[model samples]
Target: MASSLHFLLLFSSLLYNFSIYQAKPFNPTDGLIFHVKKDVSTLQYVTEIHIGTPLLLSKLAVDLGGPFPWFNCAPSSSSRLVNKRSIQCLAAKPKTHQYQGSNKKCHIFTENRITQMAIQGDLVEDIMAINQVTDGSKTGSKSITTVDYNFQFSCAPMLLLNGLASGAKGMLGLGRTQMSLTSQISAQLSSKLQFIICLSSSNGVVLHENGHRSSNFRTKIPDSMIYTPLVNQVETPHEYVINLKSIKISGKKLSLGIEEGKIKLSTIVPYTTMESSIYATFTKAYEQTATSMNITRVSPVAPFGQCFSSRENDGTLVGPKVPAIDLVLQSEMVKWRIHGRNSMVQELLG
Candidate 1:
C-alpha cells in the first residue's frame, strides 16, 4: 500500500509542475486545447468533441490508457438525427480495419471487464474540432476560431458499456498506439511526442500538447519535477513503464521483494483502471497503519476500504492524520512525498 500511495504522490507532484507548463504561448490555429470537465459523481474527466459536417457535439472521456477513439452509436431510425447523419457518412463506405498487426477484427474492452465496447464499422476520415467557442451578439451567434482536423477514427456501432461509462458519450484514447489521437496528429505538433495533463481546482485540467518545451524555446525542466527514463520499448510498446525501487511509510520501508541479481520492480502508470487484488494489497497496508496509529476505523465504503468517522454530526467522513509516505524510484535519487488528500478518500453519507 505504501508503494501505491507513493506512486500517487509522485504523480500528483508532477501534475503540479505540469500546471505551470500550461501558461505558455498557445496558438489556437497551431495546436488544439480541449476543455476538460471533471464529473463529480465518477471522478472522471470528459471533454467535448465535434464531428461530421454540421458538427455533432459528443462528450468523450479523456482516457490515456485507451488506444483508439470511439463513441456510443447505434444505427437505428429512432436514433438522433445528428448521429444518424454521422453514421451514414462515416460508416457507409467499405469497412476498413485500423488495428496493428494481423488482427482484422477490432474488439475493445474497457479496463473494467464488465463492459465491452466493440468497433463495428469502417474506419473513416472526418472533421474533429476541439475548444469550440460561440459568440452571442444581438445580431446573431457566430463561432470563434477552433482547432479542427480531418482524422480517421473508429465508429463503434455496438457499445455495451452500460452505465459504467455514463460520465461521457464515448472515450478518446491518447495511448501510444498508431490508432491513438496523439499518433494521428503527431505531424502537426512542434515538440516531441509528449503531452502533459495538469489537474487543478480552478480549471478542471489544462493539457499541453508540447509540455517539454518552454515558452522561450528552451528545453528546461522545473526544479521540483523529477525525471525518470521510460522503460525499454521492447517490453512495453504501447505503455509507459518505469522502475520503482521501494516505498517508505512513516520511516518504515516496506519490502518490495527485491531479490539479488534480478531487475527492480517495474510498474506502468495505469491511466484508467487497475485490478482489485492489486488495489487491495495497498489498502490493506494502509488500514494496518491507521490502526497502529490509534485511528478509529468505521464501516467500509463501497469502493474505499479505509474510512474514518467525522467529529461533527453531519455523517461526513474525516481524513486521518497519517505519517508521511515516500516513493523511491530506482532510476534516480528521486523520492516523492505523499500526504493529505492524495492518500485518503472522503466518503459522505446522505
Candidate 2:
C-alpha cells in the first residue's frame, strides 16, 4: 500500500509539472506570462490580475477544473463593476438558468436540493494585466513585468462565499470549455489551444501562453520529456482525461485489473480520493513486498499506512529504501519512470 501510495503521489506530481503545447510557428518573442503564488498546504496556485479601466488588483485561483472565469462582486461594489452601464444591464431578477454551453442548471438552496447560487451578471470586455517576473542576471536579480490583454469575463454578483477562503478573490478558469482562458486568448497566439505552467522552487510560478517563450518569459524542458495522448470525456468534454494500463513496483507488475473492469482511465485528477476496495488491494500488495524485504514496520502514520520509524528522535522517517515505480501507459514502449525523491517522500512531524 505504501509503495502504491508513493506511486500515486509521483503520478500527481508529474501531472502537476506536465506542460501541454501545440506545434505551430516559432516566434520565441511573443507570449504572455504570469507569476503564480502557490499555497503549499492546499496546493492551490493563485496569481494577481488587474481588472477594469482604473485597474483593480484581484487575486484569482488558477483552476484547471473550472470551465469559466468569474470574479466575486458585491451588488453595490464599483470595484467589481467595470462601469455603470455594465451594472445596470444585469437582470432585474435572478433567474435559475443554465450557463452557456453547459447542461447543468442553477438551483436555489433548499433542504432537499443542493444549495447553489444563481450566477447573474453582465459579460463585458475588460483590460486584464497579468503579473510576471524576469531574471535580471545570473545572480538572480528579479524584475516585475505586467502583460496586459483584453478579454470578456463574468462578474458574478451573488457568488457563494461560504466555503471559500478569504484569500480566494476569484477563479481563473483553465478548463477545455469554450469560455476558458485558453479559448479566450487563442486568437492572439500561434498555438491556439495550448499553455504551459512551470512551478518554481522559489517564490512564484510561471505561466506561458502557446508554450512559447517571449523576451520576458522563457523555459526549457529536458530532451527526454515524454508525451502522451489525451483522451476525451464524451459527457464532459471540457475535462482533461488520459489513459493508464498498469502500475509496476521495482520491476514487478501488480494486478491493476484495468482490463477486466469498466474503468475507462478517464480522469487523472490530483489529490484523488481512492475507493476503499482499490486502496485495500494496493495496500495488501505493498505490505507483502515490505515483509519480504525483512523491514520492520512501525505504527501507522496519521492519514498514511505502513510507515517505519527513524533511528533518531527527531521524528523523521527513515527506512527500508523504497524501490523504483513505473507507470505503464496504453502507448507502446511508453513507461514513465518514478525514481529519486519522487519515489519516496520523507515527512517530519513536530
Candidate 3:
C-alpha cells in the first residue's frame, strides 16, 4: 500500500508539471546527470530525467541490460522525426509492417522478456535536462548546473506500461547496443566514452562523462574499490559481461566442474542468481560452513533456499556473522568480497 500511494503521488505530480511546458532549448553544458532511487516493491532501480523544453520530469526504470530507452507517452501531434532524404537519418527505411504510426514517422520496437511485453513506439527526439555537479574549487563546495542533452528515445504506447512500477513511464536502457542511451551519447560526442553508476542506500547517481579532455578530470582513488575488465561476447552483443574466474567461501575455493564464462551485471534483478548446478554447490558449501560455526538453520524462504535463525547472538554491525563469499574475477588480484552485509537477507517472519 505504501508503494502504491507513492506511485500515485508521483503520477499526479507529473500530470501537474506536464500541464505547463515551454519549447525552448537550453544551451548544453559539459555534464549530464541522473538522480536514481530504488523501488521497494519491485526492487527495480529508477531514475528521474527532465525532458523537452522547460524540462518535464519523467521517472524511468533503469535497465542496465536493455538495448534502448523508451517511455509511455500520450499520443499527440507534437512532433515527428522525418526528412526527405531518410528516416531518422538512416540509409534504409523501415518497412510498413515494422512501424505502427505512419510512413514518414520512424519507430524502434523493444521487448522486455521479464515483463513478457514489448514496446512498439515512435522514434522521437527531445532535450534531456541533466543536473551537473562540477568542481567548485573557488566556492569550496560542489557547484551545480543543469546540462542539456538532445536525447533520442521511443514514445511507447500506453498499454506497454503494464508490469512496470506504476510511476515509471518507461525503461532507461543502458545496454551496449547502438540505440542504447550511452551509445547515442557516444555518437554525439565522437570521442571515447565512459559512464559511471553509483548506487547507494540513499539517492544514487549516474553520470554521462565525456573523455575528450581526459587530462582535465581526475577522480581520487579509494584503495577498497575493486577493478575488473569487461568481456564482450559474440552471442550477447548488447550485454555488459565480465569474466568470473572462480568462487570462494571463507578463503577456501569451491570445487567446480565448470567455469562460468562470464557474468552479466544487472539492476533489474533483485538478487544474484547462478546456474542450477553451480547454485546447488554454492548453497551446500554455505550450509556446511554455517553449521560448523553452530549457526542453527531455519525454515527456508521462497527464492532463498538457505535460511538461518537471525535471532542468534552471532551477529555483526552489518549483518549475521557468517562466512564471507568471494567472487574471484579475471585474476587472483581482484576478488569481490561479499561479506554478510551483502549476502544475508533478514526477513521478519510472523
**Which of the numbered candidates is closest to the native, going by highest lDDT?**
3
Best-to-worst order by TM-score is 3, 2, 1
In order, the Cα lDDT scores of the candidates are 0.49, 0.49, 0.65
The C-alpha TM-scores of every prediction are 0.65, 0.67, 0.81
lDDT of 1 at 10: 19
Local distance difference test, candidate 1: 0.49
Worst ten in a row by lDDT for model 2? 106-115
Candidate 1: worst 10 consecutive residues by lDDT? Answer: 259-268
Stretches of candidate 2 off by over 4 Å are 1-28, 74-124, 132-144, 157-159, 200-206, 211-219, 260-270, 293-295, 310-320, 343-346
Off by over 4 Å in 3: 1-30, 75-78, 82-102, 189-191, 211-220
Q: What is the lDDT of residue 16 in candidate 3?
A: 7
Per residue, candidate 3 scores C-alpha lDDT tens digits across 47-76 of 988777555788898887777778875443
State which candidate, 1 or 3, has the greater lDDT: 3
Report clashes for each candidate as comma-separated counts. 1, 2, 0
Pairs that clash in candidate 2: 1-283, 1-286
Model 1 scores a TM of 0.65
- lDDT by residue (tens digit), candidate 2, 177-228: 6666766666544455776555422234435555433233343455476776
Candidate numbers, best lDDT first, in rank order? 3, 2, 1
